[model samples]
Every structure is written in structure tokens, then in C-alpha cells.
Target: MAITSANQLELLQTAEAVAREKMIDPELVIEAMEESLARAAKSRYGTEMDIRVSIDRKTGRATFTRIRTVVADEELENYQAELTVEQAKQYLSDPKIGDEIRDEVPPVEMGRIAAQSAKQVILQKVREAERDRQYEEFKDRAGTIINGVVKREEYGNVIVDIGRGEGILRRNEKIGRESYRNGDRIRCYIKDVRREARGPQIFLSRTAPEFMAELFKMEVPEIYDGIIEIKAVARDPGSRAKIAVVSYDGSIDPVGACVGMRGSRVQAVVNELQGEKIDIIPWNEDVPTFLVNALQPAEVSKVVLDEEAERIEVVVPDEQLSLAIGRRGQNVRLASQLTGLDIDIMTEEEESARRQKEFEERTQLFMDTLDLDEFFAQLLVAEGFTNLEEVAYVEVDELLVIDGVDEDTAAELQARARDHIDEMNRKALERAKELGVEQSLIDFEGLTPQMIEALAEDGVKTLEDFATCADWELAGGWTTVNGERVKDDGVLEKFDVSLGEAQDMVMTARIQLGWVDPAELESDEEAEDEDAVDTEEAGA
Candidate 1:
């Protein structure tokens, strides 16, 4: 326990044993032991004095030293840790200011408290070293499959004993209806390795689609050898999964290779996944074709795509609708995920009926609103004038192409469309007022009557709500509309104001309420000038 000659060698031996056990560099262990011994020595050698200790790596011997800096009397910050010029000359004849001088300090007998303190320091160092080791070992292993034994369960979560460290498999990351017992061997995807205050936390996942893909890679040599590539994977966890694979070699069948002889390869993956059904399909560059493949056994009668909206309408035979949608919409959902497209499945009968209804509605809309005869309204509908907005916003030339519509008539139609929209806005403003929306927000320069209604409907009825709303929320940024992607452009589409004007209006509201500092809006001219000068100088 004491720093006696007999125990000095024992310290180095202990450090080596610890280093071996912890899988750390022996030199690191020796450094930790030296620091611990130095801390203990400080108690006897005057805590204010700079005392340090070193353990010879090869000889297993320890040395204690006291460090002092040679400083002029006027320059000295601490008398206990510094030596004056003349005093330092006693040890070093030519000692210079700011030069360090180290003298051998006699080894002190380690006291019981000092010994305990040393042990604590060594333990803290070892624990830190172990954490670094664990982090290093697993950080790059993220997304790879790891084999471990179930160590314990806490609150329905399983702790796995990975060889070098432990991994936590959260309840949500485990396959549904799957259970693990202590000491049972399991394979899991290393979802993440995070360094937390407690220690390094290696998170494991069994339900991740990557876990299944990795299982396939291990089972199929072609996938691992780069002959076959798994393009995309989607899973509903313990129920169903879809994988799209592509073959680099035209000769090799990727799906066949992944399925293996007699379904052995895919079946092995399914077994690990608690019998999660796997659909191995060929990856196609064409999105619609890929969607059809991802849907598998469902027969697609026709496919209609809306590129701007990024939605696909797939029509199947009446008998195949249930099959295409799968149980609880799982099949279509997985296919959507795999293809990165929103899929709308409908029976051929339903699709035809829906198209007819849309055409009739559009025809009626044009006839009633534009004062057009049934034939002309049908012509407008066929020309893609679905709503009054299209007619109002469309180019003059677009209406001229419609038969029986001259420039004069087109202008009249446009005027009527504007009048209709203005009426709608007037009604919307009235509705907003009835909903108790403040008149101040209704009259706001940047917001249209429609935007006001949208805000009031969402309970943003006051000036404070208007001021506090985020720009995205107020502007109605990008939104997924009926599985179709579209940008609402906030109030920009409804009002003539730009996005900047809308933002300024919000800021004005905040300023009126004194919610924000006005100084932040002021440009820092002096700072800008200095930055310009710096940039000029750097360029020169």
C-alpha cells in the first residue's frame, strides 16, 4: 500500500496487469499509476508544490520529482512553485528565467487515506479508458450486424453482452412478439453507438430493415460479393418486409440469387426475424415499374402518375384490390416506402367511376361559373381547366385555343373568374370575423382573407398568435397533400405579397406587442465596415 522499494515494483506490475485486462496500452496504465502516486505524494510534499511521479516502463521502478520554474522575483506568480534567479542558480548554474527545473523528491510513505485516494484515481482512469475503448470499438460498427448474448432485461428492454462492450436493445427496436432470454445468442444491427455521461451506449435493433438486409448479405454470397445489391428495403417489423435488389451482372438473377435454392437464403432471414414475411423483388430504374414489382402478387391493370404531385394511382382488377392493399394496408405502405412514392390503389371499376365524376364536376364548375354552354364547358374541362383558379391564372393565349372563345370572351371569362375569387375572399373574411378573428390581423398587409381564415381555423385568432407563429407555420411551407407533395408558398399564393413582406408583417406585430427587441432589426454598419476592411486586407 505504501511507496516502499518492495511495493514500488508491485505498482508497475499492477499497472501491467490492469492494462492487459482492460486491453489498453501498458504505457497508459503506467501513466495513470504515476498520476495516482503523484496525487498521493502531494499530501506529504506540500500540496502547493508541483510534484510529479514516473514509472519506468521496462524496469518497473518509480521516481518522484518536484517541478519548479526559474523566475525573477518580480515575475514570480507563486513563491511555493517558483525559484528566484539567485536561488535557482544553486541547482543550475546557468538557470534562465521561465526555464523549468525538476529535482528528485524523496519518495514519501503512502498513508492509508492517500493509498485509498490513489486506488480511486486509478479506478477512475481505468473506467475512462474502458469507455474510450468501447467507443472506439463500436463507433465504426454502426449499421453492421453484431452477435451478442442477452445479458439482462430492464423494463422490457434487453441488454446484450457484446464481446468488448454491452448494447441496449430498446423495446421498440425489438421485433414484435419476439422475446429473448438471458444468455441466449442473438444477432442485432448496431443502430448507434453514443457516448453518454454514464458510459458508452451501443444501441441495437432487431426490427430495422437493415438488419434483414444484413442477414440476407450473410446468407447470400452474391449480395456480399457485390454481384447483387440490395437497393431499398422497407419493413412492417414482425409482419412483412420488402427488399428491392439489383444485379450488377446481367447473367445472374438477383432475386433468384437472394431467394437461394429452395428459398433457403430468404427463409433463414425470415426465421431470424420471427417469421416476418419477406418479399424479394427486382429493383428497376423506372419508378412505376419498381412500384409494380414492390406490390408483388397484386396485378396492376393500369398506372397513372402525377409527377408534380409525386403520387401514383394504380388501378387493379376488383378481385386484386384487397391483395394489392394487403392486410391493414401493409403491402401498399411497404411498396410506397420501397419505391419512395405515394401509392393510391383503386379497382378499375372505381377508377373509371371516379374519373367520370371528376370530369362531370369540372364541366359543371366551368358552365355555372364561366357562363359557358355545356359543349364549351366540356371543351374547357378537356383543356384542363379544373377550377376557377386555373382559368383566372391561365395565359390569355390558353383560353384563345378553346373553340368558340375569342379574345373578348376570354377577357370576359377572366373578369368573371376574378369576380368569383374576390367574392370568395369577401365571404372568407366575413367568416373569419364571425370566428372572432381580430380585425387587425384581417387587415394585415401581407395576409389574404383565405390565409386569415386558415389561421383562425387553427385557433391563431389574436395578434399575439400571429406574432408568435413561426415563418413556416404562417407561410404554409411544403406540405404533403393527399400523399402528393406541394409547396403552399404560405400567403404568397393567395396574396400579392412576397414571403419577405409576410415575414415583415409578423415582425411588425411582434414589435407592436414589444415581444422582440427592435435593435436586432437594425443593421450593424460599423461592424459591416470592419468586416469589409478585413476582407479587403485578406484579398490583398
Candidate 2:
């Protein structure tokens, strides 16, 4: 075989045909051919020589050239491909280092072995070009829905022939008990696209919450038009799901729009999801109100939300408890997911008992801490005095408002409360010092003596140690691990310090230690505020 006139035109034709088959640019295939030819030429014309090849786009003529570079005397390592600057003077009037010299070379004859090697190189290049094309085509299509044909099953995973590429549907990503045979038409969410050593991997999913949102977008015109937006989605996949939607238009009801007339829109999505039951709820800015809507078909008697803890307590009538909790607690679980909160559901009777218990505990705390009689402590608890600190720091008028308490009696009560608190503080300070707490940490201004003792107990004895602590370390929080809520205990959590307060105190300590610049911090906060405002506006 040889690069003669008879086969020169065939090179361009072959490149065009292969490019058309792979849905890639013909120029890429031509470039691959040029390199393969160059490789073959190098094999015939001493492998040490830098040989190059170029094919004319219109004429399809293969041109071969030999190239050598003039380099410094010390850097001329390749005898055939590089020459010293002094040695290059024979070919040019003045040749400088880094100059490339080229001379036309005769194309090499391709023997059986050379032709075989050339063929393998072309095939490898074509395969790589095809992979690059496929990756480029599918990378932008992630987080979308696509239709494909089931190709085969491997180890409980389904492979789909998604036009131009194969997508893998992992066993765990499929709807429960869903099975597919060859050539079955399947619609799936493009969960991810990745370029790997073997090739590009397209991961498909049928259980993603985004799949339901996309289905609703396909079914409802309002959602497609952006008049109605899906604020949140929670799914048990193939069983039950909840979607929260809000409407930008006051005239349009988001839930009604998603549910469609006679449930047609929702029914279509349900059919596609293999009969997954869906609860369409209206979105609300108020988290508790939204949670009440999320746990539908079960009436809520009361809703108590602890914003700092991101926890909510829902009280329902005893008869509705089962309904609110659902079968296997699925209803409350989905509600928690939709609202992004930890939910504690209780019956009205249970809530009453819990409140009574709390009242008794507070009454006891006041009784023991203030040295007051049971009736007096109960009266203080009834007046919203839960702790000695409140009684100690409150105005005299507040204590006087309690029944059977005159000005003198109120004065004596406050005096007793203050003295008890002072004694406790003194004892806590002594204990903290004994535990090796530094004065710098004790004098940090926001922490009480009890808080200082707790910090010392946690090995945070210095101001630097306290500054290095994360906000969550000082404010207890709930974390999700393996799909279950886990509690993280904070040393200062018992002092009722919120996450914001912890952050403020930590930043203050950093500033005091010159670890942080307040002016820079102010600028960063201002920029963050602007970004948040921009994000909210874009989401709107």
C-alpha cells in the first residue's frame, strides 16, 4: 500500500464517512488521519527524524515534511531532529536557536506491517474522537429527562440505549420493583454525566424527586410557563410523594394548577411513576403553616416551632394521631422532608401532660433555687418566672404584680433571688478556675461563670481555643447521618445560646485577638447581603 494518487482522494472520503457515522466533525477525523500517516512516515524515514504529514482539504493530496530545530549547544540532545546554532549556519545566513527548519520529504511506502499499524492508529483515534463527541453532547443534558430503549440488564442494573449513548440505570436508582425488558421504552432523569477512563458514563434515575418535578412541568402549562413553581419535593418513590408549589400570579392557584382539571395533570405524572400517590400542597412562607399543609388529611390542633433548633412540635387530637403519623410514620416523615425540619408529633393529651410536667419542673427549680415555699414558687411559675435569673434581674414592679405581694415583699423576693444567683456564680467561678480555665476566657464578657466552667470541662480553657471553635460546637444542632437524625451536643447549649449568638461571640473573640479585621468583615457581610438579595430576586 502507498500514498499514491489512486488512494489520496479516498482518505478524505473515509474521514467524512466515519465522521458522519459517529456524528462528529469531519475535520477531527482528517486530523487523526494526518497523525497516523505521520507515524507511518516516521517508521520508514528513521524514527529519530521529526516527520509531519498534512492532507489538502480540497485536493486530498498527502504532503510529508521533515522538521529539525536549531537549539543551544547544551540542549541539542536529538541528533536527527535538533542542531546546534553554529551547525545551522550551513543552511541559513543567520539561524538562531528555537528556529524550526523544514524540508519536503517523499511519502513512505506502506508495507503489510506498516499498513496494519496505520490502520490500528486510525481506529484508536476515531474511537477517541467518538468518545469526545458523545461526552460533549451529553454533559449539558444532565439534570433533565430523556426517553430511551432498554438495552439489557446486568446485575439488577438496566442499560438503556439513549440516542447516541448508553445510560446506566443503577438498581437503587429505579422505582421499587420496576422491571424492564429489552426494547422497552423508558423515560428517566439524567442524574449525572461523567467522563471516565473507559468512556463517558450517563447515570439515569427513575426515583429522583426532580423527575417528578420535571413530569409536572411537562404536564402543566402554568409550571412550564413559570407562573407556578415547585418549591419543594419529597418522595418515597412508587409509593407516595409530596410536592409543594407556589404561584407567582395571585389569580392562579398553584395546587389547583398542578392537580389539573379532574386530576388529569397529576394523573399523568402518577401513571408515569408506576402509580405513586402524590399530595400536591400550596407553598407558604410560614414554616408551621406549610407543615400543617404538608401533613394533610390529619388535622393539627397546635403547631409549635423552635426556629433556632429547626424543630417543630405538632399536636393533634388523639383520634387523628394515627392518621398524622401515617402507616409506619410516612406522613410525618414526608412532612419533615418537605419542610426541612425535625418534626415531633404528639396527641393533645400527651402535649397537655408534657406542659404540666414542665410547669412542675419550673416550679421546683424556683422552689429549690430561691428558697421559696411551694405556693410562692407556684405563684412565680404562674407569673412566667421560669428561673431565678429572671426573678433576680426583673423589675420590682413585675414581682409586685403577683397576688399577695406588696412592694416590700417584692423587694425581699428580688434580694433573695439576687443573693442566690451571686452565690451560684461565685461557686461556678471557683470550680472553673480549679479546672484550669484562664482569666482571659472567663473575662470574654458574653459567657457566664457556668458557661466558662462548661467550656473548661470541654478543654476550651483559653481565648484562642474558644476562638478556634465552630459556631455549631457551642450551639447544639441536629445532623442527618445515614438518613437518621443525630444530635450534636454543645458545651454551651445548656446556657440557651443560639447559633447566631455563638457566631457573634466567636467573631468578637477573633477581633479581640486581632485574628480578624472588623472593617474587612463588615465589607464581606455587605457583599453577602447583596448576593443574597440578588439570589432571592433571581428565584422570584
Candidate 3:
């Protein structure tokens, strides 16, 4: 192969033909050709020469040149490619370091070996361009649904020809044991698109919760038009799924719109999911109310939500326990996922028993701490006095509401409660001191004596130690590991220290220690507020 006038137009014609077949830009193919020609020119000229090639877009004519850069005498390592500025006076009027000097070179007449090498170079460039094009086309398509043809099955993974590229559907990402044959048309969620050394990998998933939501988007006009938004979705692959939706329009019911007329829209999605049962529920801002809706078909006797723990306890009728928990706890698990909360479903009988046990425990506590008889403790528990703090610090009028409790009796109860609490605090403080707690930590306001004792037990003895602690470490929190929530115990968790209060106290300690600037914090907070307002305005 040689660059001749007769074949100049042929080069461009071949480039356009290859570009059309690969669905890539013709200029990329031309660039690849120019590079291949340059390699051939390097072989024809001295292999050490700095050969370059440029092709005219209109004329398809190839031009070859050798570039020698002028450099400092000490820096000129390549004799064929570089020359010192003092040695290049004859070729240029003035020369400087980093300046390139070019000279035209005759095009190469590539032999069989060189032609094969050039062909390989062009193919490599074309393949790279193809991969880049595929990545660019599919990267933003992630989190969307794509239609493709099943090209082949490699091991347990299915490879689909998705228009310009291939996508992989891993066996675990498939719904149930769904299998596909060659030439089968498939619809899947574009989970991810990544550029790899080999090529761009397009990962598709049929079992993703978003897949179901997308199917609904396609089937439900209201969902596609954003009249109804899918708030959350939880799926057990081909078994069962739940979708929570909210409607922006007051006239529209999100659930009804998703269900469509006579269950047509939902039926379409269900059929696509291989008969997966779906429960469409309306979205609610109230977590308890939303959970009640998410549980579906089972009546909840009561919902006890622990916002701090991100947990909810649902009490159902004895008969509804199995239904609420479903087969192998699937119902409650799905409800938990849909509401982003850990759920504990129990029968009403169990709840009653648990409440009785708690009441007995509180009654015993009051009896022991206040030196009260069983009847008096029972009276205190019945009046919602669970801890000594309430009896100690609450208004006397509130304690007087209890049956057979006069003002003098209330005063006496308060006095007993206060004495017991003071004694307990003294004991806790003494224990903390014994554990080597410092006065700085004790003097830090907001921490109760019991809290300080707990911190000391946990090896946080000084204010410095407390300041270094994370808010979550002091207030306890839930951590999600491998899709399950794990509880992290905190030193002050038993003392009823909230995360916000712990954060404030920690920041206060940091400011006191000169570790943080309060003015800087205030400015940062103001900047954040301004950014939020700007975002709201832009959104509007």
C-alpha cells in the first residue's frame, strides 16, 4: 500500500465506509489511517526519526514529515529527533528549546509485513474509538430501561446486543431463574456503564426495584408525565413487590393511576415481572401511617415508632400476625424496605404482655428508689411516672392528679424521689471519679452524673476525650452493613442523649478548647442557608 494520487480518494472512501459500518465519526477513522501511515513512514525512513502524518480532509492526500525539536545542549539525548539550539542555525533563522523543526519525507511503499502492522494499528484505533463511543452513549443511560436482543449466554450471564454495544445481565441480577435464548428480545434496567481496559461494560438488571418502577413509568401515563411520582419501591424479584407513589395533583390518586383501568397498567408490569405480585400503596409523610399502608391487607392495632432508632413496632391482631409477617417474614421485610425502617411485627396479645412487663419493671423501680410500697409504686406507674426524674422534677400539680395524692403527699413523693436521685447521682459521680474521670469532663455542662460515669466506663475520662468523640459514638446510631441495620452502642444512649444534643455539646467543647471558631461555624451555616435558598429559587 502506498499513498499515490490514484488511491488518495480511495483512502477517504474506505474511511467513510468503515465509519458507517462502525457507526463512528469518519474523522476518527481518518486519524487512525494517518497514524498507521506515519508508522509505515517511520519504517521507511530511519526508525529513530520523529515521523508524523497529516491527511487533507477534502483531498484525502497524505503528507509525511520528520520533526526534530531544538533543545538545550545537555538535554539533547535523541540525535535523530532533537538538536541543540546552537547546532540548528543553518535550518532556521532563530531556534529555541522546545521548538520543532519539520522536514517533508516521501511516503512509504508498505510491504506485506509493514502493511499487516499498519492494518493492526488502524484496527486498534478503530476499536478504541468504538469503545469510547459506546461509553459516551450509554453512561447517561444508566438508571433507565433499555431494550436489547439476547446475543448469547456465557456461563450464567446473558449478553445482550443493546443497539451500538453489548450489555451483561448477571445471573443474580435476573428475575428468579429467567432464561433467554439467542435472538430473544429483552427489556432491562441499565444499572451501570463502565469503561474498562477491554471495553465499556454495560450492566443490566431485571431484578432491580427500579426496574419495576420504570415498568410502571412506561405503563402508567401519570407516572411518565410526573403527575404521580414513585416514592419508594421494594421487590423480592419475581415473588412479590411493593411500590409507594404520591400524586402532585389533588384530583389524582397515585395508587389508582398506577393500577390503571381494571388493573391494566399494573397487570402489564406484573406480566413483565413473571407474575410477580405487586402492592401499590399511597405515600404518606407520616412514617407510621405510611408503614400501615405499606403493610397492606393486615390491620395494625397500633404502631410504635422509634424515630431515633429508625425502627417501628407494629401490633396486629393475633390472627393477623402471620399475615403481617407473611411467609418467612417477607411482608414485614418488604414494609421495612419501603419505609426505610426496621420493623418488628407482633400480635396484640404479645404487645399487651410486653406492656405489662414494662409496667411491672417501672413499678419495681419506683418501689426500690422511692422506698414506696407496691401499691404506691403502682399508683406512680399508672400516672405515667416511669423514672425518678419525672417524680423529682415535675410540677407538684401534675403529681397531684394521681388518685389519693394530696398536695402534702405529692410534696413527700417529690422529696423522696429527689433524695433517691441525688443519692444515685452521688454514687455515679463517685464511680466516675474512681475510674479516673477528670474535673474538666465533670464541669462540662449538659452531661448528667450517670452519663459521665458511662463515659468513664467507656474510657472517655476527660473533656478532650469527649471532644474527640463523634456524635454518633456518643448518641448511638444504626449502621447499614450488607443491607442489614446493625446497632452501635453509645456511652450516653442510656442517659437519653439525642444525636443533636450530643453534637451541640461536642461543638461547645471544641469551641471552649479553641479547636473550633464559633464565628466561622456561624458563617458556614449562613452560607449553607444561602445556598439552600438559591437552590429553592432555581428549582422554582
* Model 3 regions more than 4 Å off: 68-79, 82-102
Clashes of 2: 0
TM-score of 1: 0.75
TM-score of each: 0.75, 0.93, 0.93
lDDT, each prediction: 0.86, 0.93, 0.93
- Model 3 superposed RMSD (Cα): 2.3
lDDT of 3 by residue, 1-540 (tens): 788999999999999999999999999999999988888888888789999999999998999989999999988799999999988888888987888889998888999999999899999999999999999999999999999999999999999999989999999999875889999999999999999999999999999999998999999988899899999999999999999999999999888888889999999999999999999999999999999999998899999999989899999999999999998989999999999899988898999999999999999998888888999899989888779998999999998888899999989989998888899899999999999999999999998899999999999999999999999999999999998999998778888889999999999999999999999999999999999999999999
Kindly give the stretch of ten consecutive residues in candidate 3 with the minimal lDDT sum.
Answer: 489-498
Lowest lDDT sum, 10 consecutive residues, model 1, at 490-499
Deviation (Å) of 459 in candidate 3: 2.8
lDDT of 2 at 537: 100
Clashing pairs in 2: none
Runs in model 2 deviating more than 4 A are 72-74, 84-94, 459-465, 510-540
